[model samples]
Target chain A: MEPIKNDILDYLKDNSFMDTNIGLEDNDSLTQNGIMDSIGLLELMDYICEKYAIEVPEDMLTPENFDSLQGITNLIVKLVK
Target chain B: MSRIVCKKCVLDSDMPGIDINEESGLCHFCETYVPFSAQEKSDYLEKMEELFREYGGRGNYDVVFALSGGKDSSYTLHKLKNEYPFLKVLAVQFDNGFISDNAVENAKKMCELTGSDYFKLTMENEVLYETFRKAAESRDAFPRLAKYRASDICNTCISIIKQKLIEEAIVQDAPFIMFAFTPGQSPNPIIPLKANFIRWSRSIFEKQLQKIGVEDKDEKFLIKNEVIESMGKEGPRMLHPLCLWDYNEGQILESLVEIGWNPPDLNDSNSTNCTLNSFACQNHLEKYGIHPYAFDIAGIVRSGDMSREEGLEKLHQALSQPLIEEAAKKLNCR
Candidate 1:
């Protein structure tokens, strides 16, 4: 597992409704699985940007870039490069 | 078998994620809570002023205000118009089919008083009524924390309001959409509606509606994908000014009265607009053993705007049975 993905998973556990007991897959839909709502997603975006010190471009705000651990890690990794 | 209530707020051991310490008697939230410092409040106020200064007069309408005809929203609308008289506002009142006649009149009156254009947004009565009915009947239709903010029915209504209001703001090319949510309801003073975030939020609401068994997922209840595509990286920003300023209910009501804003005659202490609120709260409590307003009122008490006793009083206040029955009949839930 990528370190960024681990960080995001930890953040979800700390801040979101993501159940600690449930093992989240890389591609699981955050909203579909009830782990993240609209507000939760916003907070996640703010966290990712602040932690990585990379501003997410508006064009990159798609579900493919943010709806899962894999997608978020990829977006962060690409932006942090 | 015994209930353990928090000493700081109205939350108890009954609610999820609320653990009352044996020694402290404070809930986990209160135990780790930090109030906004004066400096932080000043910064937020300064940021809001800067936002208003930059975007107040550029768009077709400077602000798209959500007017529930409640005291908080009415007072906020009054204050914003007075503070930024140059702003062109389109105040939208989403008629959820359960709004009181008094609420409708109050909405119109506030718009008149504030010199803002009034728009009453409505959908088909049957569809709206069925949506509320489904909201009441569905279990776990929303996330647990979301349920704490409002009942399933209210979550449904408010989500619809947000979706359609964003659509309205986008279609009108408005820069800001204002909600009168109190500090307890939502702590954020401003939420930028980034393009992808808008789509993500709309999709979540769509799933919630589907979970409630609404067969026809109306476009009126969700933002269209094309609307998102047409916009730039960011759309309208959402502003919750009530969180930035002081929130004394007595002072707010007194000020509103001075401005000819009459209070509604409903028996529900927690709501000033919708008659379906009591039924929604009752349904949520029946289904989940939680009062939906407990989280909101608890946040207020935690903020020191209201005391622990006052919070509990508001939490356990007698609901309007007549109003609930009327709503239940309208929705055929009885």
Candidate 2:
């Protein structure tokens, strides 16, 4: 698994809402599926900061980068790069 | 009042008398939640409990409640104490520099009556008044206005109070910190926030705070490190017990009165136990074009606790006074 994908999955598990099997390509629309909300997005941002040591800029917290597991992984890759 | 549907939720504008822009079919409240959920109550509680356990509760004191001496907080404090006698309460009050004497009395009386420990933190009137003036004069004042609707001073006052309560919770090693928030004001259910989360959330408002030129460092006076460090691994959980149960305003008021919580005379135009409330409501309407009380009152009405006409009449009465010169003077607005 990609490092970003692993970190995102770890975060989801830490929050107690996701399992290890959930992956980037496996229907990752958490918001549309009701697995997350704005607050969840925020918690995700915090998790990314702690786990990946990435500081997500305020503008970067958009739906395109955070609405799904794929989006979150993409965001992590972008921020880490 | 035209019906306003939250472009996101099942909430309607008329459902809470929220002022809506007809063309957009949205209200200010809905706009703030565009990135959020319908705020399920059950999920919130479960999240809060999970946080409570994760934070570790050993050697932790009971919850620290921000008691406004109002019906909601007072009732919440009473309920928590009654249900969980093991729960110790640290009641903290923010002296807005102009609290009604009756409110002071109520705060004292209720603490004594409930046998709960209490503390009152008074902010510098000069500094508080100046912040209020600046916030009131700012264009983005509407968000602050919507929250309190009491006065410009109130936005400043609550910021201080919130900081103090968090600090106190940490200092006292309290595992949980609770407020008396109802649904419309802040839609979230119970929250377990770490010191870092609190810091991050406050950072979101840094721009707003900078607009008023209140130094970020000054936040330390309200939020102390000792408290933060003392706050165990589990950050404090902010709970609003009122949301957990179906409660009517009348039932709450009656229960409070039964417990010796007296309502200040409604005839006192300039005062109530919550002196800042009327002014908060007035300023809210002035800036936001909606009554600050509208959200709470509308919630009560929607819950069938009050009649729409009664809510409107109460709102009208609350807003009846022209902005008081004394209030502006206290706020140092010329």
**Candidate number of the best TM-score:** 1
Model 1, C-alpha of B329: deviation from truth (Å): 0.1
TM-score of each: 0.94, 0.67
- Model 1 residue B183 CA deviation (Å) reads 0.6
Q: DockQ of each candidate's interface versus the true one?
A: 0.52, 0.05
Task: Give the Å error, residue A69, model 2.
Answer: 14
lDDT per residue as tens, model 2, B47-140: 6556555553443467788877766777777876775565667788777666656666777777887778888877677876666667666644
Q: Report lDDT (Cα) of residue A57, candidate 1.
A: 87
DockQ of 1: 0.52
Which pairs clash inside model 1?
none
lDDT of 2 at B281: 54
Question: For residues B1-334, what per-residue lDDT tens digits would candidate 1 score against the true structure?
Answer: 4789998899998776666899999987788787878798889778888988887777789899999998989999999889878889999999999888888898899999989999999889988999899999998888766877889999999999999889889988999999998878874777888887787788788889999997544487888777878888778989888887888999999999898888889988989888999999999989988899998899889998888888899999988899899999999998
DockQ, candidate no. 2 = 0.05
Root-mean-square deviation of candidate 1: 2.0
Q: For this target, which candidate reaches the highest DockQ against the unseen true structure?
A: 1
